[model samples]
Structures are given as structure tokens and as C-alpha cells.
Target: MKSRDYSQLMQELSEAYAHHSPRSAAIHQTAVQYLVDGGSNALRTIEPFPPRIIAARGAYVTDEDQHQILDFWQGHYANLLGHNPEVVTRALSEAFANGFGLQTGFTDLLQVEVAEMLCRQTGAEQVRFTTSGTLATMYAMMLAKAFTGRNLFMKVGGGWHGGHLWGLKGVGYHEGFKEADSAGLPASVMKEVVITQFNNTEQLEKDFHRYGNKLACFIMEPVIGAGGLMPARREYIQRARELSEHYGVILIFDEVISGFRYRAGNVAALYRVQPDLMTLGKAIGGGMPVAAVAGRRELLQLAGSEHGGKVKFQGGTYAAHPAAMIAAKVFLQYLIENETQIYPRLAELGAKTRKVVTHAFEEEGIHVRFAGDRLTDLPGSSLHMLLFPYQEGLELSTPEEVRNPHVCDITLSEKVLQLALLLEDVFIMHGLGCTTLAHTEADLEYLGEACRRVARRIKPYL
Candidate 1:
């Protein structure tokens, strides 16, 4: 049996995506007049146009064409309790009715409550709120530079901190990860940011030895997202802590994806490695727009007036909006109280999903690797990404390997499968996305069936 061409498969899937999503296609045509690339976020914009979502509930999103697509994106992996969960929404409604919600432009008790919860749960001595992960990471980098009196920073290849100055390099998988992720970033500043490989302790040590003095911080994700769902090896994390301390480099864990997704707090705590600074978002907000930088008191205080505001780390206009604070506080309280039951169940579901989906594709002779399963010393991970191996026996540990086009089928997982799954009325990001509390065994079964059907179509092209 001769295999079909990859381009042919993609063309068929794109045509199907456009045919079933006519309204979305039309909306995208109109949207291009106002929004760049027909969307605001680069991730949300799908090829042949993305589905225009009107409403979301539980594990499904209602598209403009009134299609109920089972969603694995889950509000950019923030909706731990699912879209508009009653626990957070009900609290917001009550707060609004009592005239205590929305942007107050003033300090409120809710902010303090949420901040306290974050500090206590994550072992942070202090915490500050911001509006997005980008701002949280940008401010964290600035704070690190202020504390260390250094201009340089380090990040792993394929790690995405945000669209900030320090985060714009070493993100996408270019040859050697040398290309700038954006155009506007100053070349001098970009040069200061060195790219290291995830879980490669030898390279990490070499880079630290070379750039230790001038580097302000080493920022990375414990459980890698976007670039790959790869989890950092336990030894790698310990070595990073040791090297950062020895080199006077602040270690910042961008736990925005792994923060509450693993447990009620940050995944770093599970590794038993405390970073100097940690940026959190996604699940922390419970679907509201909230992000925070939490760390040692002295470093954070650099942003305070007493220190002459060396960092100037305050968030912009809608930072810590009263409603977002209340939502976060309520969400954290619920997670804390139900920690034992919630996490174990998510772990069970995640394990089941990985197994079911993997078996479904393998039955069709499709080679796939799922990256977000429980790693050494870190358990209860619910997030996932499907990587199609480009060759037999290819290691899937590091982002360098994961993003390398020669090592993995980047287009197959990132595009072709996504569009095919959408045709099955399912939405996933990167590949197979995160499993939230809203997902059920039934949902897993549905996803398995969808994969089996899609694999049948894609197998011919393999």
C-alpha cells in the first residue's frame, strides 16, 4: 500500500475545516480588516480561519455556527473549573450586586486575601498582582535585573515566557533557536539573553560558567508548555538551583501553566526546589485575567517605595481588578479545600486520556508520544501534548528535540491533526491539550473515538 502525500491530507483537512466553518471563515474575512492575521492572539488563529466561539460551558464551546465543540484548550488552560464555573462566577455576581466588584482603581481586601493565599500555598515571602502572564514575567525579569545589578538573562530553547523584551528570544524553533521571535526587540538586549536546552544539565552548566557574572536570572518552566509539554528532569532543577545560587543569578519559574494545573499550588514545590522568583497565571485566575510574580521579600520589595522604586513593578490600569481578585480568591479557596479529591481525580483522568489516545493511534500504526504525563518527582500533571516522532527511537525529553523538525513531525501535531480533530467537533491546542476538572470519562471516550477516526484518515499520509 503506497502512502499518500502529506500535502494532500492537509489540503483535504483544510477544505473540510472551511466547509464546516463557513460562518467562521466569513467572520475571519471581516476580522482581518480590524485585527492582524484575523485574530488577536497568535495561538487562537487557526489556518483556514479559526472557529468563532460565542459561548462556552463545562467542556464544550458553542461556535458561531452553533456547533458544540468539545474543548481541550480550556480557556488557554486557565479554566480548571471549566468556563464560567459557578464557584467563581456566583461569587463575582454577588460581589457585583453588592457594589464591590469591577475595577476600583484602589486597593481592596480581596487582593490581599488572594495574595496571602498565593504566598502561603507557594512558599513565597511576598507577592504582587498583574494583568497577564506577559506583564508578570516582564516585571519579574526587571526585578531580577534590579536585584542582581546585571543586564543579561537566560531561558531554555522553546520556552515561552511571554511577548516581553526578555521573552522574545529563543522561543520558536529556528536553526539553533537563534532567530528573534519578534522584530521590535532591541538587538543588544536580545543578545544578552542566552538560549539553553531544557534538561540538558551539561549545557546549562557550560552556559552558566560562561555567562554567570553578567546574567541577572535564568527563567524557565518546570513543566514546559507551548514549546513542548516536556517536564524538566528532577536533577536538572536541583542543578539549576545550585548553579543560580553560586552564580548570583535569580532563578525564575514561569509556572503560569504548571502552577495550579498540577496541584493547589506551584509545581516547583513538588520538585522541592524553591525558585527565587515565580510567575503564575492561567489556572490561578479561574478563567479571569490575573497573573502574579511571587518570590523572596527583599527582591520584591525593590518595587516598593521604600527602596526608591528601583523596579517600578506596578501593573497597568486593570491590574488586580476587584472582580478578578474575588474570582481568584474564591477559586483558590475551593481548590485548597478540595485538594485531595480534585488532584487525584485529574491525575486519573489524565493518565486515562494519555493511554486511550495513544492506543487509538497506535492501532492505526501512527507513532505518537504524549509529553505531559507524571514525571519523576512531579505527579498529578493534567496537561498534555501529542508529538509525532519523525524517526524511530527519537528522545522526547528536551524542547530542542521536541521542536526540531528532523526529530519530530512538527506540522502533523501542530496543524494537520488539529484541523482533523476540529472536523470531529473537538478543539485542541498544540495537539492534545489539557484535561480540566470539567472533563469526564465519557469525554475521554469521545476523544478516543475522535482520534481513532482521525488517525484512519491521516494514516494513509504517513
Candidate 2:
């Protein structure tokens, strides 16, 4: 490759991005007075300013500046059926119209339906609702300890289970650094957690042996989301199942991003690797904040079946909120009914998109590529495509190479690409791009066009 122009390209793109959304910049500036750092979620707060979304319908979002941009972010990958989907919205509307109360502080009939659907889909013995994926994972870890009578938790090094205290260790891999991701978190909590590299069975064995009888649960995402969209190798997952059984440790799959993204409901069903406990979120809500911790009856029952019974399973004021349950029930049932159509199309779109993007960069003499799960075996098809900017000695032929932290520079590449794509009228989520069913061939063509423009501009940084 020719000497890349990292500085000049960035300066030009920076200026162009600033020019692209003056309204968003203004909005964020005003927001800083009330909202911390101009936004609640640190991830969505972009450098210049995150786009001020005014309206979102189907595959597009209209920014505060009135720019009708085609959106691939899909509400941070929560809108698997696309924004304001008819079925979900209708369900919500009918519930509200029927005098269904919000946060009624009582068991909801909708919860029963939603739980039944989740149980049927995942073959889980029991299901319990939560307000967010963070809570689901946190409760899941607690339940594991309760059931197994163990103290330690094991998780993949670069996995993102949530922002909970126990789940904060080793979120992003920095060579020679194995510390927790946040400040102000108790150092004591990090000690009880053991981190192992994804797709590395050898390291897993070592960690298991190191933790031994104290290890309560081994929790992981089927596809590592934040660090990189790395899919666990089939053999590696099987090994996890085998070891969990041998050690009597509960296995928990954090499917917050993968639930229903692969084949209607869960990756475990698609991959045939069952876990003792599973956390479901993101797409299940269709836009609302909803999640659930589901698993074997024996394990979940340890939390207590009756009110004030044995152990506290956990109950939030917003857990199983009637509106969210109705929406989730409608979305999950629809997805299950249309699984044959929805999943394959998503996988195909992912494969086609990877080709379009890679080809776009190649044409500009850029060596850019997406990192994991290529072609039909779309393990990372949770609508989040982890971009791998060109790097040396990075293997693309196998799934086992997920542990290589140098697979790409996500921090810089993701930020730059988001700005570039935004300026091109394509809205991506923190540069973690996604695809929705509402995304058509024309939208894809626009994506390719935008990528071609971005690649040419980023030629110096290649």
C-alpha cells in the first residue's frame, strides 16, 4: 500500500462532518447544560456531536437538521424489524388504548405470554423479566452463584455482558493489561471474575483450573460485540459446554445482541449449544428497553418462586412493564412465525454488504474489510458489523483468529467511518453499522456509494 494520508484525510473529513450537522452540534451544546457530557450513553456521544434524531420510520432517520438519511444503525441494533415497526407499535398502541397501565407493580398477563414465547423458542425451563440487558446479566451471575454455591465468575476476555460491576472486567483487550473497564468500581469485584480469550480453549482450561471449585458460572456472548464482532468457534463453544458440565459450573449465554438476530430467537438454537442460563435483550424490545434472564427451572427456582420465598430472584419496578411486554410479545411471535424469511434474508444482506464494502475499499486501493463471520455462516449477523481496517498477518479464513486484538483499530476506524458515513447521508451507530429488514437494495446501493466516497477520502489513512 502507498503511504496513507491519515492527517490530511482526517482534517478534510472532520471539516466535512462539522459542515454536515451543525444542528446536531448546536443541540448537543445546549444539551450539555442538562445532560451529562451532552448525552447519557457515552457510546453515542460522537466527537463533534451525535446526530439529533427528530424522527425515525422504517429504514431512515430524519435528523434535527431535516436531513432524511438512510439509517443502518437501527436504534443501536434494537430494531431488528426496523424503526417503529407496525406490529410492535400497534401492540403498544392497543395496550395503551385498552387502559393497560405502565409499571402497575403487579404480575402482567403480557409477561406470561412473553415468557412462554421465550421459553418455547430457547427451550429454557423458566424465564424472568428485567428492565435492561445489564440487569439481566447481573441477575444471571447472581443466580449462578445462588444455584452452584460458588463465588467466582468466568467470562470471555473481550466480551460485553453489560456494565454491571461483576461484568466490567476485561471488556476490551489491551496487550499486557487485564484490568477492569471502569473507574470507581470495587477492585474486590474484579478479583472474583476470571477472564479468558475468546475462541481459545487452551486458555479456558487454564482459567477453569485456576478458579477451580470457586467458579460459579461461565458467562459470554455468542458473538463478542464491543471488543470486536468475534464469533466463538463452534468447537470452542462445544468445549465450553463440555467443561461447564464437568466442573458443575453454570453456563450463561449473554444473548443481548444475538437473541433473535440469527434465526428468529436465539443463537444457541441456531448453533445448537445450549446454556444453563441465558440473557435476552436488544431486538426483543423492538425499540423499548426490555430484557430477560432465562434458564433451567432448577437454577431459576433457586431465586424463590413465591414472594418473600427462599432467595430473591430480583424484581424491578420497571421489570415486565406492560407496554414493553406487549410489544416484545408481538415482535417475538412475529419473528418466530417468519423465521424462515427474516433470518436468511438478514444473513444474505450481511454477506452481500460485506462484499459491497470490501469491494468499495478495494477499488480505492484501500485494504479495508469486515472482521468476522463472512458469507452464509453469518455468526456476527446481529446487525453489528465489526470493521477490520487493513492489518498485517490477520487471518480471514478461520473463526479461531478472534483472539488477535490487533485484528483492527476499532477506536479510530469506527469514529472516522461514522463521520464519513454520516457526511454521506448514511447514519451508522457509533460506526458499528447494522442492517434492518426495511433496508432494501436501493439503500444498499447508497451504502456502497457512500463507502466508495469514504474509501477515496480515507485513501491516505489506508
CA lDDT scores, all candidates in order: 0.88, 0.77
lDDT by residue (1-462, candidate 2, tens digit) is: 233345666677777777877888788879989998899888778766788888989988898888988887787678887889999888888777888847788885788988998998888989988888999999999888877789899887767788889988887555622778899898797788887777677888888777857889999887767645656677778889988998999999999988888877778876678999999999888788789999898878877754234557565888888888888888888998998889888877876776777788778876655655443434536354545544655554322333343555454466778778888888775344678788887878778888899877765565
Q: Which TM-score value belongs to model 1?
A: 0.97
Candidate 1 per-residue C-alpha lDDT over 335-397 given as tens digits, one digit per residue, 9 for 90 to 100? 999999999999898888888899999998998887634345576667888888766665677
Off by over 4 Å in 1: 1-5, 372-375
Residue pairs with clashing backbones, model 1: none
Candidate 2, overall lDDT? 0.77
In candidate 2, stretches whose alpha carbon ends up further than 4 angstroms from where it belongs are: 1-8, 305-310, 374-386, 389-393, 396-407
